[model samples]
Target: MISSFSNNVYKMHQRTQIMRTTTFIKRRFSSAHITLKDSNYITREFEEISIPVPWGHLKGKWYGTRNVRPILGLHGWQDNAGSYDTLAPLLPNHLGFLSMDLPGHGHSSWLPLGISYHSIDYVSLLLRVMDYFQWDKISMICHSMSSINGFVFSALFPEKVDMMVGLDVLKPLARSSEKIVDNYKNCMNNIILHENRIISSEPPSYDWDELVDRLYYGSKKSVEREACKFLLKRAIRPSKDYPQKYYFARDSRLKTTYFYSFSKEVPIEMARYINCPYVFIKALQAPYYESRQHFDKTLDIMKQNPHFEYYEVEGTHHVHLNDPIKVAPIINSFIHKWRPS
Candidate 1:
């Protein structure tokens, strides 16, 4: 009986040792997993940077490690680099993102006093940026008006763009020749008026809440008030005239900037030239500026390409900014598939 009792005690002690060892192993692994996650979080943080341009400089918020070539991010009209703030965090940490504020829009330098901003000018801007970065090929994430610019850039220089992910806009709006002619005179006149006015005038000042309200409404309520802070990052400055008031920092001329529209034929031709992997996310609630037929025609051409992917998300025009959760997963998947090994 004494021998049997001793054996039982020995077996129990061995079982206890095994349990303790298993627990220690699990705890060590858990600690290691947490450390790795924290490291990834730290690496994904953004850094502010400026790229020198012949006109002046372009400001950008770079996310991820500096050594890697980043996907160029372009915001919508009048929006800034902060437009990608929410979405950037949701993207994979292994890849980098460089969200730029187009000239006259954010902290970037405005164009020369007499010059007019044109949609085509942005194509040249893209080229200049690529040249500055010494990137032989680039990937892009463009929103709204900038998405159209990307379309044009990729179409013109197919070899330069490796891939593109567009938010809410596909191509330049198709306009009737008659409407173009009628609007041209007004567009030119407004440019002159805005130039003369901005040369001598300061932007109107507003209280912080008022500025937020304006931004919220200016987007037709598509951008939530909470999201206004992102846009305000590059759009506002402390008022010199009034204490605690802020002024819009973007160039006023942007309001009257020249917009170039193409017909169905132009975009269709451009689509054929786009051979890179392209992902276009269309917001269901966003207005289709061009006629349905024109929009459909352009998509038809793009769909013919095997690499083209399309998604229709339920959101507003500024959906990417207001609700990045809905857009980030789709973009993440696309990026993962095409990202360089």
Candidate 2:
């Protein structure tokens, strides 16, 4: 009887060990399957698309399906579509994003030989993009200069903008009448110089590390080193002469951007016209180029609108790129609330 009992106990122990091994194997396979599925899902999310213009085609990355209208993303001055690279992935996948390179930026065509880059010109670009996509109304996610553009656009065509999310900017810098006249003269001279450069000069090429360093410091170190790869996606191209070297693909003439800025009164008046859902996020560390009073005045006007919302986050001008996690949640929440089902 004792021998039979010992033998049964051994068999039970063996069965328990076998069950433990099987459970471990199942868990391992389940984890691997999840990782593979996520990788595949990411790969299938974004589609490359282009819109043809009079000069050339505007390149874009469409994140999500074409069946639904997308939230239009516009980058800051001199930045490209890749500006959204980090932030886009963090947002809800149910909504679509159409991040495009503005004229003279990224793979998009440059303006004609003598045509200068101006704030108003971007508004026209916005209109052209809408027309090309056959979108009766637009929803925008914009940063810096592009944010200002969205402000102008929404103010001018209140009914056309369904909703807008602006990051790190509220309005264009206001200047005295004297400064405006001076700026016009400076703008003309710079435009002429940039035009000549565009015709006669090729952008300087650099090694990969050097290119990343330049971009990092060029943004005053707002962009982190590791994050440089995101901007480099659309910003660099192989040099024609040196296979190993790369040049900035964006038009160098963009450096001489002209701003047909509005006075404080103008933006205030414009703010009155904006009645749609709007969100403005100010980076705490970013310089308020316009006076605090001016910023406050604009905010007050926007506050009167029932749908307007304002937020502040801790970061630099390129906060959306450097620390997307901090910005993405607020943006995603706003979009999720206002975006159409």
lDDT by residue (299-337, candidate 1, tens digit) is 889988888888887678887776665676678778899
Instruction: Tell me the lDDT of candidate 1.
Output: 0.77
In terms of TM-score, the best-performing candidate is: 1
Q: Candidates' lDDT values, in order?
A: 0.77, 0.77
Worst ten in a row by lDDT for model 2: 13-22
Give candidate 2's TM-score: 0.85
Off by over 4 Å in 2: 1-44
Reference-based lDDT, residue 205, model 1 = 93
Query: Residue 325 deviation, candidate 1, in Å?
Result: 1.1
lDDT of 1 at 91: 76
Every model's TM-score: 0.86, 0.85
Tell how far residue 330 is off in model 1, in angstroms: 0.8
